[model samples]
Structures are given as structure tokens and as C-alpha cells.
Target chain A: MADGVAAHSERKKTGNVVEIGFTGDDAALVRALENGHPGAPAALFDRHAPHVRRMLVRLLGHDQELADLLHEVFARALKNIAQLREPARLRQWLVGVAVHTARGHIRARTRRRWLRLASDETMPEPAAPGIDPAAVEAMRCTYAVLQKLPADQRIAFALRFIAGLELKDVAEAAGVSLATIKRRLARAEKRFVALARREPPLEPWLAASTRWRDLRDDDDGGDGGEAAR
Target chain B: MTGGLQALGRVAGETAEAVAEPRAEREIAAARERLVGAREGTVALGRELATSQDQLLAYPGDDTLARARQRLLAGRRRAAGLPGFVRLAVPLAVCLLIAVAIIFGLRAREPQRAATATAVSYLVGTRAGTLGERVSAFAPRLGAAPAPELRFSDGSTVDLERASSARVTALDARGAEVDLERGAARVFVNPRRITRWTLHAGPFTVHVVGTRFRLAWDASTKRFSLQMTKGKVRVEGPTIGERQLVAGQRLDVDLSQRVSRAQTAAAKAQPSARPLAAQGASGRRHRRPVRPARQRLARTTRARRFERVEPMPAATPAPAPATATPAPAPAPARPTTLARALQHVGAGRFCQANGLLDDKALSATLAKAPAKALLALGDAARYCSAQQRARTIYLALWRRFARSPSAAAAALALARLSHTKGASALQLQQAERWLQRVSAANGASAAQQRIAAARRVELAFARRQTRRACALAREFLARWSAGSAARYVKQVAVRCKLTPERKRR
Candidate 1:
């Protein structure tokens, strides 16, 4: 699993050579995309796809159709490149597109559930050969709880906690004001905690986490974080 | 926690070299600290999930990006193949469909009843909800940050400011009646052919027919205040009965003190009023020194409908060696100067008032004089069209008493005077700086703060700082989305082309 993840980074380092690399800043890339330059799409993908993919995986969990969803996100971005309001903020805009894509997929899955066609377990497992079982179970349990949340709240929570984006970035990705995102994250956190408590597999982790948090609180004398900002 | 857990899990089996986010763990740890006081189980949940960030963020394979790029470029190729008109067809058809629906909907909907009055009130600012939500009559409209506004169907609006509460008591075709139970509310009644709106605050009743005013009632102190910004209204209350307030006038009724003062622009004389002793029937500026007897008479008759003259004890026996009364009075030199300035201003002799409140005397008394006196002198300068003198006095007031309750008013006055017609860019910039001062004033009135915020947006837009204007407009809309000026702010937002997130970003 480490090799696979590390290999992805390695491939990018080498892939820059084989591909006719079109290197530019975000604004230049946006111009390229808008101009329909032949290599713009690949250049954009190679530059931004990793962050978008990470955001999507955090937002939607480990789904089998992740690749297709990633494709759809870039496709939408490529199609609407000219509509990007601030070319300087292309990364944030792309993250927004990914969040939107994940939200749509979550809604579609929910609709499928309403029609009795799919379940949460229906997502095929990713083929990470040497991943730890505990890590895998934690991921599964976390996303299972996320499944019960509203799509918007889930996006906010996943982008904030799982992807470790700043609050403003999370808000940007969710296409909401920072205050609105805070409110949604607040609701999502409460709901996620409640749902996670119902899952027995997460009990030990929750207990350990509580103990760790208490110790950290005592150690730091309890000040707030960049989250508030 | 995420990094720590990843390391622990690595010790359990997986390698530690591929820990994706070491710095992210620090941030997550800080974020989890905010969840410490959250509801039970929430902190633990945030902690557990935050610790699993590495597991959750799976790096995508090279094939994914390659495949996505191919599809994206292919899609772009297909889109290019389509004709330009065909590209516009879908949106045009949808717009046409919406237009037809709107037309049919309007035709099918019953016409609004002329005898019925309707209003929708919504909260704005940090806790803002939908921009427009219908509020039933008699339902109390509560204020929040920045304020809550009740928008009437007739384009009128009532903004509840500073923890205020109000409700519509009676609504009808002629207009609606709003009762301010407590706190302050700024009302703007749209001008109509037969507009009739009445506002009740405590024992005071303000009868309106196409006007804009701010009415406040403090039940604890039994104080009722009205500041008429535009048009006119008739206020009936204790101490002041049926007082007519025109544009740029303010009335404050204090039941505690049994005094009601009406502050006017002091430039216009009341209709059918007796002429001032100095200024004859010709309405010409007069320079004759007014006698004490006629000054008293002028204050009595002129203040009856215009301003309430509160005589300062220091103004008495100014430089007069009187043998009748012998009380140790602090040197009456500067105090008498300020008093005479106020007396001239109260008597509607603004030019005389400005002449008395010169730069040297004003500076000498700026610290000792009460903020109210300085404000009065400044207003007199403004009314007298002495913009430079008014600017000096207002700027001094703001600088000397920056923390006083009157500082915000002084700043606001300075801003308005500096940004007057034909103001240079430098003056406009100075006006913007003064507006920022008002906004930053700790003890500033909510109304003043709201006005400053709105003006800041407009000033920025006028100065071609579209980005700042858009940012300020978005902030103003966030807090005062249901406000009277929200439409203009939204227009500014549209002109700047800022999306909500991007604007905030």
C-alpha cells in the first residue's frame, strides 16, 4: 500500500518527463484551458488532480467508481473553464467542483437507497494489498457514519476533518460562506458522533480518542485552533 | 491525532515513510481542541475521524488522471463540434419556459386586495436565514446581528436594531401600524399617493405619510427618541405633543427628566412662524447683538417647535461684575464663549454661531465643553454652510472624545460633510476614513454603525474600489439582507461579479 501511494508520487515525478509538460501558473493554466490548448486538460489534471482526488475520496469515501467521478469533475472543470470567475483561484475552484461532484454522487446513492436498489456496503473494496485491517475498518466505520449525514454537511465535515483543509477552503469547496460552512460542520459533527456511537466497531477508537483529547486539553490548557479563524 | 495514529498503525504493521500529512495532524489536533466543549460524544467523534485522515485520503493512480484528461479533452472536442446557436438553445428555451410560467402564474393569481397590508420580516447577519420570509401580523420581529428588517409590500421597510422587538399591530390598505415594544427601529415609508403609516413606541406615537425616520423607546429609562432622516412626520408624546419633524431633524423625549428636545437642521424656519428679532421679515442675515430679554423670548417661541434650549448656568453674568450674587464660579471666559455659541445656534443665528465658535475658542473649549455643545456648534456651522468650520469642529470632537457616546455621531457627521458635493478625491478618502472610524467606534449607535457600513460600500464603489465595495456589500448583505439598502448592496455585488464564497475568500 505504501509502495502504491509512493509510486503514484514517483510516477508524477517521471511522468512530467514523458508527457509534453506544459508548465505554468494557475492563471496561465486557466488561460490554456479556456483557449482549448491540446495539452491543457492533461496539464491541469497532472497539476491539480491529486488534491481533487484526495478531496473527493475524503468526501465520498472509498468507492469503486472514484476514478469515473474524478474524471467527471475534471470534465466539468474543462467544460466550464471559461466561467471560472477568478483565474487566480483555480485550485479552490477545482476543489469546489470536486465537492459538487461528490455531493451529486451522494444524492444519487441516497436516491438509489430510496428505490431499494443499493446499500452502503455495495461499494466495492479498493485493492490495497498490504493495508492494515484496523486502518481499513476505521475508514469504513467513519464513512458509514458520514453516509447518514446530509450531503452538504457530509461534504463540509469530510473536507474540514478528513481532508484537513482550512475552514475557508472547506467553505469554498462547499460553495457556501464560512459561517454557513461552520454551521453545517457543527451539525455534521454532532450527527456523525451520534451515528458513530451506534457502531460497535468504533467504540474502542472513540474511547481512546476521548482519553487522548482529555490529555491534550490538560497539556495545552485548552486554547482554540485555526479552525475558529 | 491523525499523524500520531498513522505512526501507531505503522508500528502495528504498515510502513511509516508514507505518512501523507504531518502538518495536517497538527492542524487537526488544533481543530479537535475546538470540539472539547461540544456535545457529548462529538469531541470523541471529531478526534477519531481526524486521526484517520491518512487512511481516508487515498492518492489516485496515474491512470485515473490520464483517463479523466482524455475524456475531458474529448468532451471539449464534442462541445466544439456543436454550433454556437445550438449552444444557446437550451438556456434560451428554459428562460422562455420560465417566462411563460411566470406570465400564466401572474394571470392566474388573484390581484392583491387594496385594503390588505402585508409584510415579511427576516433576521440578517451571522444568524441570517432566508432573505425574504413572510411574517404574519402581530408576530414579534426580533433583532439580531446586524439587525432584522420588516419589508412591507408597499416597498416600505422597518429595521429593528440593537436587540429591539417590534410587531405589526394593525395592517391595512392605507398602510400598516408598527408598535415598537422596546429597543430601536428605523422605518422608511415609501412615498405613495395616499401613504399612511403610524409607529408607536412607549407613550409616543409617530404619524407618518411618506417619510423615513428612526424611532427608539427605552422602557427602563422611559426615553423615546426619533431621528427623521428624510421627509416629515408628526410625533405625539409626553412633554412634546404633536410635534412635526421634517427632514434632518431629531426629537428626544425623556420622561425621567420631563424634557423633550427637538434638534433641527436650524436652517429652515417653521412656516407661519414669528420672525427672529435680529433677522427681520426680509429674511436677511442680521449682525445686531441680541439682547438677553429677546434671546429668552426667541428661545421660548423658536424652541417650541424647533429646538429645546437648555441654558447653561455658566452662560449667566458673562464678564459682568455683578454685586447682587456672589458665587465662586470657575473663570467664565471659555465656558461663556461655548455658551454664547450654543445660544446663537439655538436662536437660529447660525452665521453668528459660527462667528462665535472660531477655531481658537473651539480648540480651547474642545476638551472642557460637553460633547453635546460641540455637536450643536458643529451642526450650526453645517447649517450656516460653513463646511470648513464644521469639518474642523467635527474632526476635533471625534479626536477629543473618540470613546464618548457622541464620537460615532461626530465621525458620521464628518464623513457626510467631507463627502459633500464637489468634494475632491482627497476629501472623499478622508470621508471614507471617518466612516471607518464610526464603524470601529465601540460605543457607536447601531443605527450609526449600519449607516456607516452601507456608506462604506457606496463610497468604495464610487472610488472605483470594486473589490472592496463588493466585499463590504457582501458583509452588509450578510447582516442586513432584509434592510432597505440591501437591494443597492446586491446591485453592487452584481456589478463586482463576486460569488458568495469567492467574495468571502
Candidate 2:
């Protein structure tokens, strides 16, 4: 890992010296890619995959989906490398691709709901209750309440609170005014608080219940220290 | 409520104590360790995916690469066979042929359609910003207002005043009925068609073929009033009244009461023989005879009733013009800059006004303006353009502001710009780095989301896994379908074979 990081840094430096503007190295990578250099694409993938994977995990709410998506993102990036205009902004470009791909995923899910209303799977139950039941319940309630908000508000709230992004970043990502983001967050917070109060603490109870204990016992190894904690 | 508040207070206090108390330091450390473990797990998984992508791409003589190369070669061959001249000409010729075919096809089919089918007409003008426009856009249109006494070809008459935001959905041989919601409208139906006309508002229904009556409903009040202006109307069902309202008469249908009241107030309000004109029918003839005496009595009664209502206070006269310096009278309109033009555009109330301006407007708006305002307007235009899927506008904005020192705003815009087609992967990576820099510098909230969303799209394409691609596409679509990125979401979904489904509550 250290060697990979060093090599990546060295490539970045060499690439940076070759070009003058913001995406100098990226441009060189594109040129190298066009010339069929072996390391150009690998370096690009290594640099950006982590950020993209983090985003996918947060977005899809599942590890398996994120893993699958991360692979696809890089492969498509390599295949379409020749089409890239600015190599320096490759990370952003990849991110854009992920966003587009994720959007398609969401749209398809929405359409499938009508055909398979009962078949749609619920979120997976957490394996063990290491975290406080109340906190877990809070998180579940937060997600449920968030689902009720308008798309823009939900995006802003998620970006702001769950992902812990700054106001300006949220605004930019949402492509709205700071004022608008503020407004959405305010409204979302109000609705979330109201919903949290009104809904019973079902998730908390479930987490604390004996069924959860048994499930944890079955899933964990014979030693139950981690499961109990 | 108090109990709930106390519980919340206790929870907050506990959390605070957990964080600040020295005794809990070990617990906090343990929690941090757990969090680090989680992060490390995620990082390891990400590394594995990255390594796999690298290996796949690096495979010697990979079948996927070979296939893609073959496809490209075939595409090139196909392109070469068509001479440049023919290549251009064929597309033009095909387009012209298709256009002609469509025109002729429509023309040939036109005559077979029914002649009296009325095209859907919008009665409430949409103004976008105003309450009326918002209401009309958000709320469903009820049925059309019925003429005072003239029955439509479909034999339905509606009360115009009680038919606020109503529309005529169907007018055919079966007769017509007015669908109304909140607001008041009066309808006058031809007596001959009385049995065929109907009035519907919320849960209440009134059947009439020939009647001149007013229907008023206040959604807030939950009260419905139906007053006859001419002819007669019979109430049935929930409202069981067999009263006939003559000329200069009124009837009130209390849907909640199941009892309607007949009053002679109509006669006391109208003195003239003039009748209210039906909406959207400039030259339609009145179907009911005018009774002048009863109308006169109705007018006097209405005048007296109006007198009893409180009069609006008169506006106070403006302070006497300053003797020394009268405010300059407004100057005649003058040619304006892009900013001024934007203001005008704003006034026009187009949803995509900022996006509609030419590059000249952008430069002009930015010139001499504060950086913050310029950035705000640019951001707004970027969003507006994104919503409209105006690629040219986004490109223009990027070219103008990509490297500016506006920090968060410029970097975010650049990231979006670099993500578009025709941009190289290297450029996109740099854009992502810039976004990360911005996030680190200013802690912008949307950067992570934007980065995440973009990454998901990239990964899906890289893997060529249709199911995974579809799933990610749906997630993004659900979040952005109502935002400025809806069009991009649609494009991605179409490419990925993911159809967005409407969210069910």
C-alpha cells in the first residue's frame, strides 16, 4: 500500500510538471491512455475508487451494492478513457458517472414497486445490537421520516447531516442556493423531529428483544462477547 | 408534549454527560476505536474492488476489450464506406423523408376523427409565482362553469360563480355537468336539458338538465350554496328539496344539512335585464327569458345588502410633495445590461429565466457585481440550465468560472462541468480533487453527496453489471427526479435500462 501510494504520488508529480493548468496530469494520463500505457489507467482508478465507493455505500445503503458499483465505475472509466477531454478532472468525471448510474438504479426501483409491491425487500436488520437501541431507533426513524420529504429536501438533509457535508457543499451538490439549502434543512429537521416524536420506538424494542439476541448468537462465533457488547 | 420534551432533554443531557465526563473517557475511546475499525473495513473493501478493476483491465488479450475494439473497428468501417458527402446527405434525406411522412400521415388521419371533440382547454391561467398559479398548478381543475340558462350541447349547465377553477371535461350528446371544488360559480341550463345536467363538488352531487342557479362552496367553510338565477333547479339525494327557483330567485344547497333553502334574494339584487355571459363563449345566446321587474327588485335588495357590509378604508393621501425636492418622476424605460435583463426575466416569471439568457447576459451580470451575487446568480443559472438540460449553458458557465477563486461555488460547478460528456477522465479526477479540496477547506455538505453520486455512476459503468447499474440509477433518480438533475437522471436510466418507478408512501 505504501509503495502504491508513493508510485501514485510520483506519477502525479511527473504528470503535473508536464502540463500547466489545473488538470495537467490528467491530460497527460489521457495522452498516455491514448498511447496505450499500462499504468495510466491503474493510477487513475486507485486514486478515485475509494471516494466513489464511499459515496456508493452512503447512497445505496448496502455494502454489496457499493462493491459491485465500484467495479463497474472503474471499468467504464477505462473503456471510455479515450473520450475524456480533461484527464485531471477524472475523479469528478467518475463521480458524475456514479451519480448518473445511481439515478438510473433509483428510477428502476421506483418502477418495480408497482409490479412487486409485496416482494420489495425491507432494509436488512442489523446483525447485533452493539449500538444503543435508542440511537439505532433514532437512525431508523430518521431514515423513515426522510423518505417522506421532497426529493430536494431529502438530498439536502442527507448530504448535510448524514454525510456531514458543509452548507456550501450541500448547496453546490444540490445545485441550489445556500438559502434554499438552509430552508430545506430547516423544514426537514422540523418534520424529522415531529415524526420521531409521533412514531413508536419499534426499532429500539426490536433491537433489544430476545429474537435479536438469538439472531446475534446464531450469527456470531461461539464466543458471544462481541455480540453481547 | 411536556413529557416528550422532558424525555428528549434527558437524552440530550445523557449524551452530553457521556461526552464530557472524565469517567466516560474510556468508553469514548472504545467508540472511536470501533469507528476506526469500521472505516478501515470500508477502506479494505474499496481497495479490493480497485484491485479487481485493475486486474480486469490489465488482463492480457481480454475478451471484453477485444470485443469493444472489434465494435469500434466495425463502426469505423461502416463510417468509411459511406463517403462524407453521402454520410451527410443520407441523414438529411432521411430526416426530410420522415418529416414528410409524418405530415402526410397526420393529414390523412385528420378527417376520420369526430368533428365535435373539444380540445382540452385550460381556464385558470398559470402565472407560476402567484398564489393563483401555484394553486392551479398544484390543484386539480373541477368542472366548467355552467351558463346562466343556456345548456351546453351536452345538456349540462354550471353555476359560473361557484365554479372556481372548474373546467368542462366533456360536452357531448349525453349532456354536460360542471365539476366544481372550492369557490362559487353560477350555472344556467336550458330547461329542455334539465334532466341531463349535473353538478358535482367534492362528495355532493346535483343533477339538473335545465336550470339557472349559483353554486358556492368554501372548502374551509365546508358550505355549498346554489342559487337559481333563472328557470328552476330541483335538489335530490343528500340535499332533498323540491323547490323551483323562478326568475330573480335564489336557492342554497346545504350539502351538510340535507336541506336546501329557497330565498327571493336574487330578485332584490338585480334591476337590469342584462345577464352574465358564459365564460369562453363570446357570442352564445341566453337561453332564459329576462324578467325586468323581478330583476329590479333583486338589484335593490343586493344594493341594500352591500350597504350593510363594511366598506374598505380609503387610502390616505400621499404626504404633500416636498417643496424643496420632489422625487424625480420615474424615467422612461432605457436599454439595460444583462443583470437588468435578468431582472426583467425574473419579472416575466419563467422557471428557467436565468438559463435563457445568452452568454452576453452572463458576462454583463458578473461585471461590476459583487463576487457573491455573481456566484449566486451563476449557481442559480447552472441549476436552471441543468434542469432544462441546457448543455450549452452549462458549458458556457464552466468555461467562464471553472478556475475562479470563488472557492466552494466555483469548485462545485467545475466538478459538475467536468462530469459532462466530452470531458476526459483525467479532467474529471482533477475536478473531484478540487471538490475534495473545497470540502476540506469549507466543509461544504453537498460535495460528498455529489462525489458519491458521481462515483456510483462510474462504478456501475465500469463493472458492466446491468443489475447493479440499474439499482444505483434508481437510487439517484429517486433523490433527484424533482430537482434540477431530473433530465440527467432520465438519460442515465435510459442508458442503464433502469426505469424509475414512482415512490409509494
Candidate 3:
């Protein structure tokens, strides 16, 4: 009975801290952000910046330019903060902004390749220390294949699976309907698997599993609902 | 009993519901794990598959977050500071630039247009387009080394040698007319079923359907020349009138001298026969031994008769003495041995002609016989069905007077005899070699050259060398589209499926 009281007290303390930080809720935080409250940018950054950075790294595959891309995403989100339709969905809106920034960079990089002004040698190396060399090499191979995919499909794939976003969140981030995101993911999954099968380092990752095999048999129904959950 | 059964049923229903709920929850959890990876348990294989991508997770350092915050605030400030119109106009300009780039990119993928048929032929080969970007009939094109070649749609080509200038005078789908303005050009006309090509140089015009030849015209000298290496062509000009030339023949015309000469290799090899027409201007200084008065009278009569039979004018056999009296009967009462033989042959009495030509007395003087007499004696023997005798006579003519103008005719006769239907393979090979000699022999007459070229095609077809036969047939048809042998050559080309042009529908 004492242990239960202590757990309840700890939960109450966490709730109080959340209430104190934004002064009320996410709606209040969005208002403060829109009004350019002196503390609002720092508060938003502290809350969502890490999430956005993780999304970018997953999408672009450990690029050295990850920091710059992160900055671009936040800058766009703040500049277009007025365009956010729902104040309560600020985090979701920020995710959408990050997807847009990644897509733009992808398109710009493709253009540079077409113009022969840039090449594979110019791609930045993974900057994070303490990463396994094999993992880094696999990440390099994954991005190389990803670069060959269309921008919309690449973003959808990255958001849905790599970043572990729920199906609806992926749809919202890509500015597409939930059904469209599902279709994009299906195609991206097949294509990515087909391409990844060619890479020796990525082979083990795509190895068949009992759960995945069972899911594939009954994949038609409830996949979106389950993924969303 | 009924109440007890109802209670049991309720208990079973409750038990069934209890058993199904956790299983459904476990399945849902597994599905979630499949998509988002296992959050709190041992990693599933599905999540492990993305080992590389899963490892890509990174959190921004404090410094990165600070810079990003500053950048966001600064952007917000910049947006607030900007006037509304400037902000809208900047994006609009960027969109316009993108639109322009898209338009250019689409245009770049389009193919270049081909030149029109009015061009007659276009420049092609190594130096294509160097003669200007366009080609039109009647437009003189000058070319030198590294000169652009003119190519017709039908696959004909004219390679202009250095310092040469030529122009297309007329054009159509079937063939074209080219005028060699100055210098030299090597022309190749693709033989089509209905070709009608013409090449003009100065006052001379060579009509060709398909052929390969070199044509040159010198404006200052008023001279025109054509050397045929393949096929046949009809050349019309001053002095030459209309003459059919074939592969291995060369024709040179001098307007100032009112002279035109066609020759072949055999004729060129003859030192004495080379300058017969050229020496006409030098008159009587080089006149030979005077014949007896009676012999001179008989020679003049025979020359008159031979003139009617021979196509090309031959040199006066032996000039008549100035003091010789004219014969009243106009017949050779006691003609020389050669004159007697020629008369019999001209009258179709081949047996009588052969008998006289094969006489022991004639054999002693055969070494000194003129090329004309030797050629006439071979013809008489051939017509009399004296194969061995004719072969012997022709060989003698070719050997003793290898450089004589008539030697080409002798070689042609040998080729024909060897190419006969009953001849062996060895004979056919011999015939082909003879024809090659006739074609390559310098100063050979045009008629003999034509006969030799046509004979070669026949020999090749007979030997079942289909490719060579078709090639030679195409060449023959190019030069002699309306020639007597054209029908035969065209048939060969059609049979071989190597006709230069596609068959007309």
C-alpha cells in the first residue's frame, strides 16, 4: 500500500512538471511560439528538436549535413508557424516541416548529380563517433539505394518504418492521405527489399522471421490499425 | 435440471470469452512490434533487419540545438520584417526560373531535322558540313583535301579531289545530274532499276545510270576527260559524238584540237599506236614506206570498205602514195593478202577468209602485220568455228602487239572464247583474268572495255560467285542502264537480291 502511494506521487509530480513547463498544454505552447515568446523557441526546441533530428538522420542515413538539415527544418517550421492549422498538433506539424526539408535536399542533390557538379565521392561521411564500421557501411549502402528511389517514396518509407512513425503520422507528415501512404509504403518496401537483397551487409537484416512470415500471410487486414497502435 | 443446465452454459460462455481476449491482444502487440520495432523486449528479426538504419538515430548536441534555435528565431524575424509583396515576389521569381529550365530541358531531347529532297544530295563523310550547311542544285561547291563527299539519298557518292569544284545541275529521287565545273571528281552512282544520272564537264556530257568513274575538266584548256573503272556510260561531246564507254576505258577530249581519244591498257601499252591521232597535226613528216602503186590503190578501196564495218575510226593502214592513180573498177584486182582476207570476212565467207589468213605465206609476215590485220584474221577464224585457230591468232595478236590499240580487242576475244559455256573452270578463270587485263589495260578502246566488263559479270555469274556477280552487275547497270547487256545484268542483280535500289512496288 505504501509502494502504491509512492508510485502515484511520482506520476503526479511528472504531470505537474508538464503543466508547469508550457504553463498549461500544447495549445498554450503553440500560442507562445506564434507570439515569439522569449522562452518559446527554446522550449519548442527542447521538446521537438531531438525528434526532428532523429527523423532527418533516419531519412538521409547518418549524413554529416544532418545538423544543417535539422536547422533548416526548424527554421521552416518557425517561419511557417502561422500556417499550422491545429495548435495542439505542433509536433505533428513540425514533423511535416522536417519531411519537406528532407525532400527539398534530396531534390537539390539529384539536380546537382544531373548537372555533374556533384558525385558520390562528395557525399558526406557519417559524423557520429562510436558507430560500428559495419553498421556505418550498411547505412552508406542503404542511402545509396534510397537515392535511386523517387523522393516521395523515399520519404514515406523513411518516416513509416525507419523513424517508427505510426501510419497516420507518416501520412500526415507526407501531406498525403492515409491510403496513399500505405500504397507508397508497399511499393517502397518491395523496392527497398529488392535493392537491399543485393547488398551483402544488408542481407541479414531482411532475413525471414516467423512473425513477419505470419504477418505476410494475413497482411491484408488491420495492418494500418495495428501499425498505428 | 433445466436451471442447472442454464448455469453450466453461462459458465462455459464466460470461460470462452476469457480465453479469446489475451490472444487477440498478443497478436495486436506483435503487429505493432513488426512496424515500430520491439520497444521493451528482445528485438524481433524484422526490426533487426534495419540494423543499419536503426543505428542512424542521433540526438542534436546542445550547440546544434542552440544554432537551430537561433536560425529559427532569425527566420521568424526576417519574415516579420519583410513587406508582404516582396515576400510573394521572391517565390514567384524562383517559380518562373524553374518553369524556364523545364522548358529548355524538354526542347533539348528533340531530334535534329533531316535536310529536304530539294538538296539533291547532302554533304557526308569525314568533312561533312564543311561545304556549308546546305546543298542545293546548281550551287557550285568547292572542295579540297579533307573535302566533304556528296551523298545522294539513293547512296550514290561523289568524292571531290583536291582543288575540285562541282555542282548538282538537276535532281530527282531516281538520279541526279552533276556538272564538273573544274578539276576532278570521283563519282559512284548506285544502280537503281530506273536510274538516269548524267555528269557534264565542259562541252562533254556522260550519261550514266550507275557507274564509278573519275571526271575532270580544265576550263583554261577547254579539255574534258573521263576514266571509267566500273560500269558503262555514253559520252557525247565534240569529235567523239556519242560513244559508249565501259569499265577500264579512258576518254580525253581536246576542244582546241577538235580531237577526242578513248583508250584502254592494251592500247596504251602500244608505243606506236598511242599517238596516232595526236600526230595528225604533225602531218607527212613521219610518213612510212611507200607501197606499190597498185597496192596503194587496193589499200584505199579496202580502207573504204572497212570504215563502214568498224565502229571507231582506225588510223589509215598505210597512207596512199600521192602519185597513185585511181582504180576505175574500185575493186582490188590484185589486192594484198590482208585485203583479200578482210574482203572474204566482210562478205561473211569466214571459211574462205580463215583459209587465206592461215596460209604459210601469211604466217611468215604475221610478225609484221598491223594490229588491224591481226584482229581481222582472228575474227575470221573465230566465225568459221575454228576455235583452236582463232585462239592461236588472237594470242599472236596480243603477244606481238601487246601495246597495240587492237590488243584490247584481242584480249576481249580471248576472254569471250574462254568464257564459253563448254569451257572448264580453268578456262573461266583464264577468261576472268583476261577481262581484268582488258579493264586495267591503259588506252583500251571504250567498246572493248564495255565488252570486257560485261563478260566479267557473265563469267562471275556462271561460276556461282553470286556476290561478285551482283557487284559487277550493279556496276554494269550503272554505266549502261539502257545498254544491250543491262537486261541480263539486272536479272543477275535481282536474282542475287543485291539490287542497289529497293524494288519498285
Give stretches of model 2 more than 4 Å off.
A1-42, A75-89, A114-121, A125-138, A175-180, A199-229, B1-505
Ranking by DockQ: 3, 1, 2
Q: Would candidate 3 be rated incorrect, acceptable, medium or high by CAPRI criteria?
A: incorrect
Residues B52-156 of candidate 1: C-alpha lDDT, one tens digit per residue: 433334234435556556666566331232246644764676798999999888656533434333433333322422322322222233541344577676778
- lDDT (Cα) of model 3: 0.60
In the order shown, the candidates' DockQ scores are 0.10, 0.01, 0.12
Q: Give the Cα lDDT of each candidate.
A: 0.61, 0.43, 0.60
For candidate 2, the lDDT comes to 0.43
User: Candidate 2, residues A1-229: lDDT per residue as tens digits?
Assistant: 3333234333334554531111226666566556555555555554555455544433444322444455566666667877676667665577556554554555444444443422345354243323344434444555455555555566655555444445665565555687777777666544444444455653332244343334334543233221111
The regions of model 3 sitting more than 4 angstroms off are A1-46, A113-138, A208-229, B1-62, B75-224, B227-505
Candidate 3, residue B353: how far the Cα is off, in Å: 13
Candidate 1 matches the true fold with a TM-score of: 0.33
Q: Which tens-of-lDDT digit does each residue in B453-486 have in candidate 3?
A: 7667767866878789888988887888864445
Q: After superposition, how far is residue B376 of candidate 1 from its true place, in Å?
A: 99
Deviation from truth (RMSD, Å), model 3: 19.2
Best by lDDT: 1
True contacts kept of 3: 0.20
Query: Against the true structure, what is every candidate's RMSD?
Result: 25.1, 35.9, 19.2
